[model samples]
Target: MKKVKRRAMSVLAIILCLMIGVSVFTYRFFSQGSQWVNFTANKHIYSNGVLIGGAIYDRDGNPLVHTVDGVRKYSDNESVRCATMHIVGDKKSNIATSLQKVYADELMGYNTINGTYSVSGTGNSVYTTLDADICAAAYEQLKGKKGTICIYNYKTGEVICLVSTPTYDPENPPVISADDDNYDGVYINRALSSRFTPGSVYKLVTAAAAIDNIDDIFEQTFTCHKTEVINGQKIICSGTHYEENFEKSLNNSCNIAFGNISRQLGWNTTAEYAQKLGITTAHELSGIPVVKGSIATSGGDNELSWTGIGQNTDLVNPFAMMRVVGIIANHGMCVEPYLVEKVTNSSGFRTQLPPNKTEKRYLSQSTADTLSDMMRSNVRNKYGESNYPAGMEFCAKTGTAELDGSQVSHSWFVGFSRNEKYPYAFVSFVQNGGSGAKVAGVAVTRVMTAVKEKVDSQSTAN
Candidate 1:
């Protein structure tokens, strides 16, 4: 009797173990089934790691990439292929955030139930919110310089133009060596992966902080003598602006006055406002991660002053800065930027991605209005309206970030259009490019002019 009872207990234990193992397998199969099916090792949708099917098109239905008889092909125009190489991706998966790599499962038509088998002779189609012509225009403005230019519709969160330079032709990729100066950072997308010293463009954040924290900030007066001593450190300015109010200080890009303002705001307040302004926040666009900007709050009074002026240990991502300007343009609220516009499955079922509806209010309406007026004054009085297209109503700020070891300062131009018809925000950054108003600012004007022309033409056609 004892032997028989032990046998029954052993049988029960074995049954329980098998049941638990099956449950765990079932759970993973339901949760991560798509990842397994979309793996590059799969032979159905991918041919030696390259997607065998599916097509990628721009907003205007311009084909950017398509699979031709089991072979991948890019745009016929070499310039367009190079301009959008970073976004469309290459065969070897060098660009991680490219549509080919990030949205592979969608392109392969892998659903939870049907898997890759649901895919017909061809894979699904991906339609992006990018404008091929605008991207090509931006690429031309880069002029072989290493930099990035991104422009997006602030109201709809549609990224119209995103161009990163040092890109090669996707149809014929070059062998990039580590010591190749021209090909440095060729694999990385500068707009999404890199951070820059924001320069005086960061003053926008300091200005926003002042408007909210300082009660009588607009009424205050400051003096600039081309240089001022704060916390025993010398803060230099481009020119001497004898005496000026808060608005004039910004218009002149007075470092001494801003350094003094920073001293008053202190490190704690400055860091708090930087976080609130989305400078220190990481955002994801259409499943691609954007690196966040950084600021250091733990420092002496001198460091605090420099930080306030966007100098000390301050690094900003161009995309983040563009979003900040977009938020300001949208009156303190903004839709998160996205690239993928829609997807059409092989079964003829189309899915249109809705704009991000999460109402993120980073600033109060009053502060945004005040800043808008100040930025407009910046374009009209400081940056010169002639620098932009006529009647653009362009509001802008330019920054020249000084680097160490005699490297030329990085040029930065960030701003938004107040024109209701073309509600867009843009960021232009040029590495080792001197004069933000000249180099980076010119890039912005050229690209925005192209954008304005397109908008007007579309309106006429409609």
Candidate 2:
């Protein structure tokens, strides 16, 4: 009787272990089943690790890339193909952030129940919110320059134009040598993947912080003798502006005045405002993660002053900066940017993505309005409105980020359109480009013109 009882106990333990094992397996299958099915090694969706099926289309139904009889094909227009290579991806899956790699499971029509079993031989279709023509125009403007251009709707959160430089045509890829300086970081998308020194464009954050914290910020006045000393360190100005008020100081990009303001705000408050403005945040656009900008507050008064003027250890992502401008344009609230608009499966079923326009307020409406007026003054009084398309209502700030060891400063132009019909925010970065207003401003003008034309044409057609 004792032996039988011991045998029953052993059987019960074994049964309990098996049940627990099955439950864990079931949970993992449900949680991570898509990853398993979409693995590059899967024979159904991949051919030697290259995605075998699916089509990618732009907003205008222009085919950016599609698979024909198990072979991938790109757009016929060479310029368009090269311009969108970073977004559509290459054959080897080198661009990790490409929609092709990020949305592979959906492109392959993978579902927990069907698992590509019901997918047609041609696979699925991913319709993006990108405008191919605008991308092409921006790419042309970026020729021979290593940088990026991004423009998205502040109201709708649709990324209409996103073009990264140093991209090669997928059909005729170049042999990039590691020692070549021109092809450095060719695979990386600067708009979404890289960070740059914010330069004077960071003044917007400083201004926002001061607007909310300092009651007499606008009424403050300072004199620029081309330099100012803070904590035994010299803050140099580009030019002597004599005596100036707060708005005039911003218009002149007076470093001396900003350095003084920085000393007043202190490192802690500056870092706090940077975080609140989304400079230190990592945002995802349809599963494609944007690299976060960074700031360091552990520094002396001199370093703090530099940080306030977008120097020191401050670095910003172009996408995030563009989104910041969008927040200002949308009156304190931002419509989170997104790329993938919808997906259609092989079985003729279409799934439209929900709008990511959350009503999260990043700034007070009053602050945004004040910033908008100031940015408009920047374009009208400083950058020259005649440089942009007529009636663009362009509000912008240009930054020339000084680099280490005599490298030309990076050129940055970040702004938005106040026109109700074209509520777009844009960022243009030119690596090693001198003078943001002259170098990056030219690119912004050309690209925004193209964007305006596209918008006008669409309105007419509708």
Candidate 3:
């Protein structure tokens, strides 16, 4: 009787073990095969391996913006022009996904054996130093206008908010068949994809180059009376101004003074300074297909003169401008800007992104400090007392770029917040808009205020 009881118990234990083994096998087989495809393979392809340059979230892990799927409708008939047009890019997900399909396996993990294939996503998450509240605020303020707003972390080289007007939905993106390259057919990611004349904003580069190359730039004053002749070509300023110092040249966006300074530095020096600021070939390192802007060195003295004041085919994108400001904020170090904060695996293992290769000493510490001070002065002294923020030490540079025949100018503002923390930095542009101070300044302030409000609220809670 005892032997029979022991045998029965052993049989029950064997049955249970077999059942467990079968369950394990089934799970693995399904998970590694069809189940994986069902779970991972995109039900709707947005863009092949293009990935639309992954959307970014703030440090607090809130999503500020994303691509729109073609499935929905986006409307813009408000005070703000259309922030989505630039930052959110276009509704090319379907075409992007289709084009990426060929490269998908190469970029993403796949399960393949015995004539079967399954694809899994890249499984990476982008962490940006941008505060979400700030991005939304900027977008909210610039909704009806053709504009752009960019924010970054100067210390980390992380972009906070990149808002461009005239946005589109990424998920239900608009359909684009073959041979569609016109700007109207697609949404341009103006922040990185579209290039514009830097206008007054280009002066930042001119200032840095002049200070770096020319001796006694502070003491030198360039005489200006509305227009000046360079290489026998007439160039005019927005206003008829007299002799001015470097500080005033920047504050008033004086073309004649900047043009003279550029003439002194020459084209070679201007190009070199731009390259150092990560404006030239540095786009490749940003992990996006950047539209290269031209600083026409071949245009001789006249071209150089115009380029100095951000005219005559000197092109740049909003995000790139933000990076240039970031270098100034970081006191000369310019890091390769990135969006992905971290990556995680299916097993719940977290991995930090590869460290950004930071190129140090793009500008001398003194040069950066000087530039920052000048930017601050421009904001405080020139923008008028009413526009200035009461409490913050906002260092900024405003730009107004003239496009050949266009009546309105593209407005731009790039700046860093707070004297104490230097916590965040950003750039904003309003397309075919007014002056940088009147339009871009208000947008930047709104975004900064929103970001501060959110941060302060969180601090109070903690």
TM-score of each: 0.95, 0.94, 0.75
Q: Candidate 1: which pairs clash?
A: none
Candidate 3 weakest ten by summed lDDT: 94-103
Clash totals for all models, in order?
0, 0, 43
lDDT of 1 by residue, 1-462 (tens): 999999999999999999999999999999999888777887877777888778899998898998777678888887789889999998778898788888887777777777765435677889999999999999999868989999999988999999998898988888887899998888889999999898899999999999888888888899888977666778888889988999999999999888888878988899998899889999888888899999988888778878988988999999999988998999999778889888987666784455455558999998988898899999999988887987779999999998888899999999988997889999999998999999999997999999999999999999
Residue 439, model 3: lDDT of 86
- State the displacement of the C-alpha of residue 439, model 3, in Å, after optimal TM-score superposition: 1.5
How do the residues 1-462 of candidate 3 rate in per-residue lDDT, one tens digit apiece? 999999999999999999999999878875665334433334432344234322333467554332344232223322222333333223333222121222232223233452122123223234445445555567787766666787766776666666655544443444555674333423555666677778888899889999888998999887789988878998889987797888988887889999889989988898888787867764742345655667878677778889888889788877778888888877877765655454333333443446466666788989998999998888778876456555557888888778777578888888886454446778888877778778887888877777666667787899
Winner on TM-score between 2 and 3 is: 2
lDDT values for all models? 0.88, 0.88, 0.65
| TM-score of model 3 vs. true structure | 0.75
lDDT of 1 at 241: 93
Give the residue spans of candidate 1 off by over 4 A.
Answer: 1-13, 351-355
Q: How well does model 2 score by local distance difference test?
A: 0.88
**What does candidate 2's lDDT look like per residue over 1-462, in tens digits?**
999999999999999999999999999888999889878888877887888888999999999999876678899898899889999998879998998888887787777777776445777899999999989999999888999999999988999889999898998888888899888898899999999998999999998988888889888888889977777778888899988988888899889888888888988899898899889999888789999999878788888888989988899999999999999999999888889888987766784455555657999999998999999999889878888888779999999998899799999999988997888999999999989998888898898998888879888999
